[model samples]
Target: MLTLYRPGDGPWHRLPAGPKSLVLLVIVLGVSLLPATWWCAAVAVGACVGCYAVRGAGMRDLLRQVVTVRWILLVTLAGQLVFTGPETAVANTARVGAAVVISGLLTLTTPVSELLDVLERAMRPLAWLRIDPQRAALTVAVTLSTLPVLARLEREVREAQRARGGGRSLRLFAIPFLVVALKHADALGDALTARGVR
Candidate 1:
């Protein structure tokens, strides 16, 4: 299922998923509201590093999370630099990067089952609005599981393109990537149907 949970006996790992998720939400919101300043960016990134250290996660694990979103961060920085200035660009990129790291830490410590349980329980209040908590939780689970799959598909497509001397052509990359993604979606739908999801 492409679970990212890293088994550990640290305090963060022992923390309940509900509280951990709430803390993550608060951190993300706080980061979003902070001004685009170098100090703010440094503080945000520093907080994430502190959290990782407290959680006993290695620098390598944090680096892996950063690497996963390197391209996105670079593009964001570039666009901001052109539209705004270097200061705002770096601050915004750090803000986004910190948020991603916080999220990765949550998933690293909490099991998928625990997260789904928390999500389901949290959605119970919405049942009066005809919202099915189970279905909603299942949807979230599927979405989370699909992200790694899509990432893998993207890497494979890029590698194949390069092998055929396609260089960095977006068109060549997008075409095969989309096709494979659609195929994965169709298969996932079939599996869900077989399991009586609907």
Candidate 2:
């Protein structure tokens, strides 16, 4: 699998995973609680960009995060434009983009193992409720790891379609993407099972 963790000696990279995750959660929650306005969205997105700059992330890295969710943003913008107005559409799209960028930054700065460790520690108190902390952490690990893989798969599929002179058809893209994603899921399941994760 492709790792999202970028090695760096930056402050974000040096910070412990627990507090970093808490800050991420707080930012997302705070943004969600804000009114859906252009200023709110702009502030959220601008803050994420500033964080990237502070962490010494290049423009390319920031663009990659935006590119990965371009389709989702387009759809959201279009839908909101139809139901609401252009301002709301822009605000909502920017909010979603900001959230994705923040999450991407977290994954880029923190290793999967560290994130899993934090999750496991946080979940320990729920053991009496029949919650398996290890399993919970595993689920998060799989999710965090799978996002980049899926994003890469999407780009590969899109390139293949372009090579075949195919246009941007969602149905065409979805079919092959889902097929490959399921194959990857199956292989991952087998690997995890072999390691006794199940």
Candidate 3:
């Protein structure tokens, strides 16, 4: 959500978005390619995890993010554990966790607008193929902006369900959430049109 970006004078904040993104990609790929050994993957994951402390994020903040992605991680762990083994499962899970943490760190340090600018600049050469970098970057920016709105909507829907009591149907929230999301999209589109984004 919007919780990703934290305003501070940290070293990560001082780094350029391009290099940070490149390093993040390399680190994630390198970790993922490492052997599924406890010792090897653990060291890499530990280093990635320690980035939170280096970037001034608190334990509570890190735990909140992990909790948000718990379901996805749980499913991945269960599948790996069943098909492979405990060692592979743990290693794969750690790899995924480290990748997510590193990506989150990038977003936390870089502002969304600046990240979009970096993306646009990187994709400028693709304009020769009729791919508009500005539009592409704007799409990503809008997508990032919607995440926090969706998260807020989810929380509100959950609270409303709890207030009503005696029911546990995902449809109870999904339908309303979809409706609100569509409305948000419509508004966003209208705003973009007004601004002559096209």
As a whole number from 0 to 100, the lDDT of residue 41 in candidate 3 is: 67
lDDT measured at residue 43 in model 3 versus the true structure, 0 to 100 = 69
lDDT of 2 at 86: 82
On TM-score, the stronger of 2 and 3 is 2
* Model 1 ranges with Cα > 4 A deviation: 1-3
For candidate 3, lDDT tens digit of each residue in 142-167?
Answer: 77667657767777777887798826
Candidate lDDT values, in order? 0.84, 0.83, 0.76
The model with the greatest lDDT is 1
The backbone clash count of each candidate, in order, is: 0, 0, 0
- Name the TM-score of candidate 1: 0.90
At residue 152, candidate 3 shows an lDDT of 70
Better of 1 and 2 by lDDT: 1
lDDT of 1 by residue, 1-198 (tens): 222778998888988999988888898888877899989989888876877777457677777777777887899899899999888999999998888777777777888899889989999998999999999988987787787678788889999999999999999899999999999999999999999998
Candidate achieving the largest TM-score: 2
What is the full ranking by TM-score, best candidate first? 2, 1, 3
Residues 90-195 of candidate 2 have per-residue lDDT tens digits of: 8888887777777777788888889889989999998999999999988988998998999899889999999988899988889999999999999999999999
